[model samples]
Target: MTKRIAAGAPPGLHRALSIVEETAEGSKLWCAAAAVMACTGGRRGRAAAAAGLASVATAQLISNGVCKQLVKRRRPPKEWIPHDEVEDRPDSSSFPSGHTAAALAFTVAITPTWPLAGALCALPAAVVAVERVQSGAHYPSDVTAGAAIGLTGAWLTRHAPRLILRHWL
Candidate 1:
């Protein structure tokens, strides 16, 4: 699947995906979006931004810190990717894609508070998932696992406060 995507994607798409992946490094894209939402979007936007940021942080810690530490899978082979970006992939374990996790975490966290914004975020999140495979950074299963981790992070972020309150009250 990685080989087919790497080989089949056109140069234009490859360039676009590379740019998206680069922009997403360190969660810059999502942070910028959060800032925008906080500044321009009213109360709902602020809530969504907070949730999204929290989810991203949670997902990052789990996927990059814990899960990656436990799993020692290697990235897809360079030969499988036909692009220059393959050389830039990190040497970390590839059992889960941290980038995909962060992206999905942000998108899912914001959905309930701001469905339209969540819909907008979905496109890039999906792109990041595909780019992980296309750039030889992860296998499809890695991205899938990352996505699951992301959803879990979002769920925790969204419900933890309520659950804590319910327990206390």
Candidate 2:
């Protein structure tokens, strides 16, 4: 299934997606989002930045520490990928895409605080999710799992503080 998807991607998009896929590595994309939010600096901007940062961090930890460790899935076959993409691909477990997790988490978390920004942010998030599969780094299932984790993480980040305070009180 993954091989078919990889074989079908446009040659032009492969390079761009690989470049954008870098956002997944070290959570640089999320950092960029936060930086953009920081520059906007006001009540809404701060809230958006804080939520995006928190979502990305927590989703990354859960995906890398818990989900990947538990699944231990291998990446898609290198042969199925274009020559340029092999080196850029990840070596970690493949059941859940860390890149997609961070991308979606950032987008989902930002939506409530800044709906327009979040809507704009989703363009790249959607790209990275598909790119994870198209680049031969992850399967569709992996991207799906990562997205689920990201969405759940975003929800948790938004609501956890209230829940925590409620329990304490």
Candidate 3:
């Protein structure tokens, strides 16, 4: 993983992170989802969006939890200074990044109804994953695994809303 970063992180990763971190842009995505749900009279749409958010959060936890426990990798050595360009500093395990996991999970959940939105979400996720490596907070492999966990969780969450409503309705 280190070797890969050493070789080179992807192009435009820094720029992508910058775009996502903005308060307006990031919040807009959430607002858009909320608006879409709200417009449908807060029935199935709202329920699904809420459930999807929870699923993404849960998936991030599981992914980060399992990976951290298994890998038990420490942060980069103190002597090692991260790439100057990377801004986010996460003082956690250097495996299966939580941010990447969360982003991918959210992307997965939103993709079905809003393909364009999902694609937009993915841009930041990819950048954040790369930033995790540049910031010395995650190995490339760790980000990859986190992404898998997130995507799987998002998919599972997608159908969970219907099952939940089935009982209550």
Candidate 4:
């Protein structure tokens, strides 16, 4: 099902999607959020960066450490993907997508403080989510679960500081 869905994509779009997928690797999306925040300068900049980074970390833990550990599902087989796109895939269990999780985490966490930046990130985040499935790195359900974790992590990061401060005051 997933293989067919991915294979049906327009031939012209494959290269663009592959490029987006590659550029989103590792901490690039999260770091981009941080750089945007920092460029704004002052305390707001620092707070946004801190929140985005913290949320991404939490989401990564939930997606990779918790959900992936519990699910233990294999990625769509390499043969199911385009020959050119399979080489860079990860060896980890594929359930919730860590890439989408981090993309959403940074996007969501930054929204409260920097709405414009959040808006800009929405495109890349969406692309990353789609690419995870298209690249055979995740299933649709895996991407959905990852998005949930990202939102939860962003909520926690945004509110936890206030929750802690209440204990002191």
Candidate 5:
């Protein structure tokens, strides 16, 4: 399965992933921005934080619990994967990437309030995607699926209250 995916990827994707991972200024910006959003008391800011956190949590639950067990794919052995600067080697199955999912979820949740937040999330998300490759944990498609799940989760969280209200009232 890994061989099949690797064969189809565009050229130099690994290099692109490395470039994305090496940049940290963007992530710092996100952390500071997320802090500001948490503290601002603005309705939009609060909503971003709430939706972002909730979406990420929900996405994680679905991916790690349901999808992983269902897919049951193995990660590339440490021997075959390249060395990288990422902080940790994830223990989970590699079919859907959790980091990429969370980063995309953050973007989805925060973009409405802070445009930069979404772009900034992309930096780390890109890193996570690359790290998966570098760490030999996932194929590009798996990371892509994880990101889609997160984005969908974020979108759902943002609109859920209104949907519920309409249904209930």
Candidate 6:
């Protein structure tokens, strides 16, 4: 699949994906979005932004700090990718894509609080997922695992406080 995408995708799409993927590094894009929401959006937007940022942070910790530490999977082979961007992939374990995890975490966390903004975020989240595989930074399974982690992170961010209070009280 990675090979097919690397070879078949047009130069224009490759450039676009590259830009998107680059912007996503270290969750920079999501952070920027959160800042925008917090600054320009009213009360609801601030709440949504807070939720989204929390989820992103949780997802990053789980995906990059914990999961990647436990898993030692290598990235897709360079030979499988046809682009120079493949060379720029990190040496860290590729069993889960941190970018995808962060992207989905933010999107999912914001949805219940702000549907319109969540819908807008969904596109870039999807792009980040695809770019993980298309850029040879991860296999599809890695992205899938990352997505699951992201959803779990969002769920935790949304309900953990209530759950903890319920358990303790």
* Residue 36 alpha-carbon offset, candidate 2, angstroms: 1.3
lDDT per residue for candidate 3 within 32-136, as digits (tens), equals 554665466346555546654765666766776676777776765543534554334455567777767776777677667655656766666676666666656
Candidate 1 residue-wise lDDT at 73: 96
User: Residue by residue across 1-169, what tens digits does model 2's lDDT show?
Assistant: 8888887778787778777877657888878878888788577888899899999988999899899989988888789875567666667799898888999999999999899889988999999998888888899999999999999889999999999999998
Alpha-carbon runs more than 4 Å astray in model 4: 167-169
Give the per-residue Cα lDDT of candidate 2 at 56: 91
Model 3, runs deviating above 4 Å: 1-48, 78-88, 160-169
Give the per-residue lDDT digits (tens) of candidate 6, residues 20-110: 8888888899989989888888998899999999999999999988999999998999999988888798999998999999999999999
Better of 2 and 4 by lDDT: 2
Stretches off by above 4 angstroms in model 6 are none
**For candidate 2, what is the total of clashing residue pairs?**
0
RMSD from true fold, candidate 5: 5.1
**Mind giving the per-residue lDDT tens digits that candidate 1 earns over 9-126?**
8988988998999899999999998999888889989999999999999999999999999999989889888878888889889989999999999999999999999999999999
Using Cα atoms with residue i matched to residue i, what is each candidate's TM-score against the true structure? 0.97, 0.94, 0.66, 0.89, 0.71, 0.98
**Best candidate according to lDDT:** 1
How does candidate 2 fare on TM-score?
Answer: 0.94
The candidate, 1 or 3, that scores higher on TM-score is 1
As for model 6, its CA RMSD to the true structure in angstroms is: 0.8
Candidate 6 — what's its lDDT?
0.92
Sort order, lDDT high to low: 1, 6, 2, 4, 5, 3
Q: Ten-residue segment with the worst summed lDDT in candidate 6? A: 1-10
Alpha-carbon RMSD, each predicted model:
1.0, 1.3, 4.8, 1.9, 5.1, 0.8
Is candidate 3 or 4 superior in TM-score? 4
